[model samples]
Target: MNLSTLTDQIEQRYHTQAEYPWAKFPDYAVFRHQNNRKWFAILMVVEASKIGLLKEEKISVMNVKAKPDEIGSLRMMKGVYPAYHMNKEHWISLNLTEIEEGLLFELLDESFSLTIKKPPQQRLHKIPL
Candidate 1:
């Protein structure tokens, strides 16, 4: 799927907005949970060679958090690479132009869920008679 379509899916499914945090990289987009402000996914344009491609053409990619064990297997798949600027062990960069729509959404859901913080429990006080 294209960038716009993927972005629409993220906004519609997660009810969150994308933030352009870096002034220098204006095209880069970051999706984060509103409550915690932790990034779930980041979309950026980079040289294809940076992600191991032979050529230096610029390509758009989405970086998402992944479980440690799954990272190895995911790297074996086409279009998935070690995260660009995040922790390589727990995160992965997916070539937006190369992955399937279903897989992309699935990974995005995983990333979104990973960044969510649990709500605090409310405690009730007993009244003295």
Candidate 2:
């Protein structure tokens, strides 16, 4: 899916808007979780070489958090790549124009879920019973 559509869907489903925080790189948009304020996805234009593409042209890409166990297999998928600027084991970069919508949304949801704050578990205090 394209950047506009992806961002729109994210907004609609997650209730979070893309924020452009860098003055030097205004094209970079970050989607962050509201509660913990952790970033789940990033949309930006980068050199093809940055993403390990052989070509030299600029490409639109999105980086999303991935489960560590799945990162290896995810990298093997078409239009998916080792994260360009993020940790390879925990994040992945996608060729925005080339990825299928379903897979894109699937990964997006996973990322969002992964980065959310976890609630504390309740503990029962027991006396000698």
Candidate 3:
């Protein structure tokens, strides 16, 4: 589906005020482009080749497929995504496109929910009324 269609579907289902939070994954990034004076957001997941065990099966896998520009800026480290981006000894990137939107939104919802679990440091001093 195209970006607008996907965004519309998300809004219809989730009532999202905005979606940049979905773009915050270190392995994924968001790009906004203006077309005909309108805005569009693209959620791109990066690709990486790494070895990992899935359900105890040893295999070599390619992480998510992302636009070339989006793949170049990822920070690689251990224990990030199952292991890391592309260089870690374990873990892998599951191409967001390969997964169903329902599942992806499930993950996105978890991430968004967890992100708000902590109060902002600046606002920690004030209690909610």
Note each model's CA RMSD in angstroms. 4.3, 1.7, 12.2
Please rank every candidate by lDDT, starting with the best: 2, 1, 3
Q: In model 3, state the lDDT of residue 27.
A: 30
The TM-score between candidate 1 and the true structure equals 0.88
- Candidates sorted on TM-score, descending: 2, 1, 3
RMSD of 3: 12.2
Q: After superposition, which runs of candidate 3 have C-alpha atoms over 4 Å from their true positions?
A: 7-28, 31-42, 48-94, 117-129
Cα displacement (angstroms), candidate 3, residue 107, comes to: 0.9
Across 1-129, the per-residue lDDT of candidate 2 in tens digits comes to 566877798888999999999999998999998889999999999998999899889999999999999999998899899998899989999998678878988999999999999999789888996
lDDT of 1 by residue, 36-63 (tens): 9999999999999878888869999999
What's the lDDT of the predicted structure labeled candidate 2?
Answer: 0.91
Native-to-model Cα distance after best TM-score fit, residue 50 in candidate 2, in Å: 0.5
Best by lDDT: 2
> Model 3 over residues 32-116: C-alpha lDDT tens digits?
2222221122243333333232443322222322233333332132312332343233222433334455644544444333333
TM-score of each: 0.88, 0.91, 0.34
